[model samples]
Target: MIYTIHRTNQPPRYRGEWNDTVWQHAEIASIEKFHPQSSAFRPKTEVKALYDDTNVYIIFRVQDQFIKATYTTYQDPVYRDSCVEFFVMPMSPERGAAGYFNVEMNGLGMMLLYYIEDATRTTQGFEKFTKIPQERLRGMTIFHSIPAPMQEELTTPLEWIVEYNLPFSLFEAYLGELRPIAGTRWRGNFFKCGDDTSQPHWASWSPIGEALNFHQPDKFGLLQFA
Candidate 1:
């Protein structure tokens, strides 16, 4: 499973619009492989990615139901809400070295991100991990179709979009300079989940053999930057 990240000379405006001219040329991938534990309700989730000189842009469209979002603070657990996640390893972990980064965002645009060095499951969480400080993400831009702090669940059918751009400098801080990203290769996986929604479900772009885990970097698909 390889997804090409097309080069975009014209950066996206990050307005959460999927049909915009800049996004129309980008290839789309669907997050449809579901875990056996997921409920019968499965949302139609689609993702597209592009890269410019400064940042990597991504957008997610979810035709969903049973939407809910309560966590609003940075670094909070946003996976309990109607959420989309992107896990990427800019550089493969050779031996016990550089690890991957997970960016999880709720439907309302609230996000949780971490730099995980060791993903060994521990009582507190992973054996070794660091929450990417909010300050480092200042250059990142996010857009959401729905307003935030939704404490109540809405079971009606609806479509929501989440879009964001992550500056190359943000990744450079931890993974060193990622300049000349074109022609580069990385490993990543896209996911859609609602842990506490009325109809809980887990879906992924790259199929995961694990029962309910998204930390398997070996299961990630190839990301070819064009």
Candidate 2:
């Protein structure tokens, strides 16, 4: 679950480390033992996150006896195999509504799907959607423990480290304006998937109750900007 600290005055310049200390297994039922239906997948992994003024840093330790990703068509949902993803929704009622920004990574260390737009609309117009360029979206890089292979062994466990420098400019574009303060809270979620499994392991920075939908920003926890 996501841990949040609201700042009424000045937001803390968070340079500390954060991780999933609650559930560290691949059984969603283990997490659901406490969180109920809000749990998404069964991940035998650990993810740590950190943030500064310019960007947020994330590291994932994924343990999979079988890890694989089949590259399908674009915008087809990247959760088909072992992957890590981040979803961010900027909260601003004045700018119509909050939008979604997603970054996904497959086990081959291939980075795909950095999509951003208003949550009210569909991604069908992604190529035509010129609000954010492909360069800016793919600019955020990843430093992986393993590189892509012509063929991969699904029996080995894989670990990955990812770093993202999300420009304030992108946030401004999505929000349709700019602000002075560097600190603010945004609704967000972190997810992972296991290929062909009957159930995929899932978790969020915020507890989303009994519902499995991560699109509900209202259920998101506070992400204090510093």
Question: Which residue ranges in model 2 land beyond 4 Å of their true spot?
Answer: 1-41, 72-76, 92-97, 112-132, 150-153, 177-183, 195-199, 209-212
Query: Which one wins on lDDT?
Result: 1
TM-score per candidate, in order? 0.95, 0.62
Model 2 lDDT tens row, 115-180 = 454333455534323334555555354555545542443555444443334554566655665332
User: Which candidate achieves the best TM-score against the true structure?
Assistant: 1
Error of 1 at 185 (Å): 0.3
TM-score of candidate 1 relative to the true fold: 0.95
- Candidate 1 ranges beyond 4 A from true positions: 92-97
lDDT of 1 by residue, 1-226 (tens): 8999999989888788899999997999999999999999999999999998898899999999999989889988999999999998786233222788899999889999998888899998899998898899999889999975776899899999999988878777887766536678888999999999999999999999856999988899998889
Output the lDDT of residue 30, model 2.
15
Each candidate's number of clashing pairs is 0, 6
